[model samples]
Structures are given as structure tokens and as C-alpha cells.
Target: MEHIKIGDEAPDFDLPGDGGTRVSLSAHRGKIVVLFFYPKDDTSGCTVEAIDFTALKPDFDAAGAVLVGLSPDGVKSHDKFKKKHALAVDLASDEDKTTLERYGVWVEKSMYGRKYMGVERTTLLIDRDGRIARIWNKVKVPGHAAEVLAAANDIG
Candidate 1:
């Protein structure tokens, strides 16, 4: 798979989302799209990131941007995680890891000398034309939503 870069057209994907809906990147054309890929549902960093995005959903909407959180977990797991956190952002499930791999977020990671395949924390800001405007790799959750929002506002 080719690695995405700034100004490149973002890869389009349609996947199962929370509330039994499907989210397709192409459906959000003519608006900025925020795609945040996390390792797992209900995990520490991921939860904080989701909640932060949820809190800022109004601001993002005002900025004319769409937010989509994605993980390798299934739709049921996404539903549970969203409900458990009272999250407002859309959470998409990439059960087969195809989308994750396409975005180049799935990789071999190591913890305590144990290595395994997992989603790397990542966030992409796509412009109205579906081109990548910015990318945050190995993301640190703190204040990340605000940063992305700032970037979105800047681009707009």
C-alpha cells in the first residue's frame, strides 16, 4: 500500500459505524473530514481522544468538518464504547483491517519485548476535495482534537 502524504488524495473507505450506520469518506465531500484511527475501543488514550472529539463536536460542526473515529474492533464493540463514554463522534469498525492497512496505520508494535500487529494511533485531516491536509502519526491524545480543529479552521 502506498503511504499517504499531505496534498495526496485520501483513500476512501466505507465501514460499519456506531448506531448501525455506514461511514464513507466520499460521502463527506465538499467538507473537511477528520479520520482518527486508534488501537482499540475503550482503551485509555483512545477513550480520552474520543471523548475530547465528542466534546468538540459542536465546534467541528461549526467549522464544517466531519469526525470519524476508527478501530479494528467490530461495530458492536464500537457501539458499546460510544455508549459507555457518551461519545457523540461517529466510530467506525475496521474488523478486517483492510482500511487500517490502506491508511498504513496497522503495524508491528512491541510492548515489554512482545511484538504484535496493531493499529498505530493516527489522525488525518482531509480537505474539502478529499486531499490530505495534515497527518498526525503516533498521536498523543492530549489536546489533539483542539489541534486538529485549529488546523481545520486554518485551512477553511
Candidate 2:
């Protein structure tokens, strides 16, 4: 799949999310949306990223934007992660990886010199018009949510 680019319509997807809700990307239309894709539910990097976003939920909400996290983990795992971290943002389970592939975040990785398929940490900022405003690929977990929020405020 091709990478989602600015000005393109954000692909729609419905996945089982944390808290027993089904989250659809299209449902967030007409609002600024932060779509962050991570590798797993509670790994070090993913956990840090989730916590950061959760901590900034108030700021993001005040800015009239919503944050949604995605990972291949099932809804059960997501529930555990959120409970353990007291995360404020919603997490969606992309167990089938359909949404991840559409955004081009399901990618190759190298760990211990072995190549494998995994989620390449990424974040997409969708504008109020349901169009992609910006994309942060190959993301570094630190300070990423703040950066995304700044961009959302700028583009929203």
C-alpha cells in the first residue's frame, strides 16, 4: 500500500478498540484526529508513547482534537495496557493489520540483525475535512505526541 500523504483522504477503518468500543476513522470526520500506530500493546517504546499521548489528552481535547492509538494487539491486551498505565486516550486493535497496511505503517524491522514484519511507529494527523494534514513516519517515541498536537493545532 502507498503511504498516506497530505491532502489525501484518510482511509476509513473500523477496528475493535479498548473499552469495548469499535473505532472507525471515518467516524472522526469533521474533527482533527491523531492516529498513532505502534508495534505492540505494552512494550517499552509503545508504552512510553501511549503514556505520553495519554498525558497530553487534556491538551489535545482542548484543541478540539481526538487521539487514537493502533496496534496489532487484540482488544484484551489493549485493555490491560490501558488499565496498567491509566491511559486516557483510546486504543484500537488492528489485529488484522488492515488499517495498518492502508497507512503503510505495517513494515519491516531489524532486531538482533534479524529482519521481521512489525509496525513501524508512525503518526498521521487528519484534518477536519477528513484529509490527511501531515504524516510522521519512522517515529521516535519521545515527545512525539506533543509534536503531533502542535501540528494539529497548526493545521486544525
Name the best candidate (by TM-score).
1
Tens-digit lDDT string for candidate 1 (102-149)? 999999999999999999999999999999999999999998999999
Candidate 2 lDDT tens digits, 35-111: 89999988999999999998899889988899999999999999999999999988999888888888888888899
* lDDT of residue 66 for candidate 1: 94
**Residue 5's lDDT in candidate 1:** 92
Off by over 4 Å in 1: none
Q: Which lDDT values do the candidates have, in the order given?
A: 0.94, 0.90
TM-score of 2: 0.96
Candidate 2 clashing pairs?
A: none
